[model samples]
Target: MERPLKGSAPNADDEQLLRGRVYGRDHDDPDPGPLPHQTYAALVGGPLDGLLLDITGWRTEEVDDGVALITELGRWPGGRALYDPRSGEPRTPGPGVSCRFYYSGDTP
Candidate 1:
């Protein structure tokens, strides 16, 4: 009955459902469902900020998606998720690089 608002704020009903998920109340159930845009409202909050979630080992395409996710953050106000440099790769920009997921690959 409750769910996160599509591409928008977490509605009152959606918040209730998220609360349950955050506390691991109904976690065993499959399909935690579509994730929240900012990863916070989908029961996926701050823990990731300190973890190693880089695309260093992923294929180029995967890297592109990751970068795009960060770039698109500017498109949505109040969105505050950042991918930290856990792998020690310098996040330098190359000329003509599209705003997509890309691994630094320790090539800097």
Candidate 2:
């Protein structure tokens, strides 16, 4: 039987089947089940340019505040690469992209 599309509402039977069990590729099975959709933020103009940040389950305020990424470019080894939201309001660079972040600077 064909599997339901990702993100489609799960019916009672589907819910029951999924309850209390992790679904994915098992040691014996090579075929992994359908993967869920994910949200991401695109990083631009920095050491981490072109990297996608997984923003699944993140709050709006948290995304706007931006994030500090660990990179070798920091003051010391494994330092931080800071990034800020490109805009005060959220803007999607493309499909499946929740927002875009611009390089701010690096920190120790």
Candidate 3:
């Protein structure tokens, strides 16, 4: 999904795309649309860059602390992708991307 420009409201097309798409829904379940007040952690850089992480039930501290995500880059089976919360302006790589993480080698 394309990140909307910072400070820019989502256009009609954006809303249309989000329609009928439910986050974390099982493949077998019918589409029930997104949950209310849904929020996400936009990953920047690394193998999972440009991906939106579901932070629906996460606390403020958890979002601030960032997370170690599982990835398939570098490692044949799997590895951990470390990410950190971004601070200050000019740090966000793009719109909706509040966290920035770099490729610092994969961790098993």
Task: Compare the candidates by lDDT and give the number of the best one.
Answer: 2
Q: lDDT tens string, model 3, 11-70?
A: 455455433443234434665444445555655555555456666666667866777776
TM-scores for all predictions = 0.21, 0.58, 0.50
Show where candidate 2 strays beyond 4 Å: 1-36, 89-95
Residue-pair clashes per prediction, in order, are 4, 0, 0
Steric clash pairs (candidate 3): none
lDDT of 3: 0.51
What order do you get sorting by lDDT, best first? 2, 3, 1
Report the candidate with higher TM-score, 2 versus 3: 2
- Please identify model 1 stretches exceeding 4 Å from their true place: 2-6, 23-108
How high is the lDDT of residue 35 in model 2? 24
Question: Candidate 2 lDDT, tens digit per residue, 1-108?
Answer: 233443233344544443322222232444322324756666675555655676767777798789997754334446677888866655654336677788887777
lDDT of each: 0.31, 0.58, 0.51
Q: What are the clashing pairs of model 2? A: none
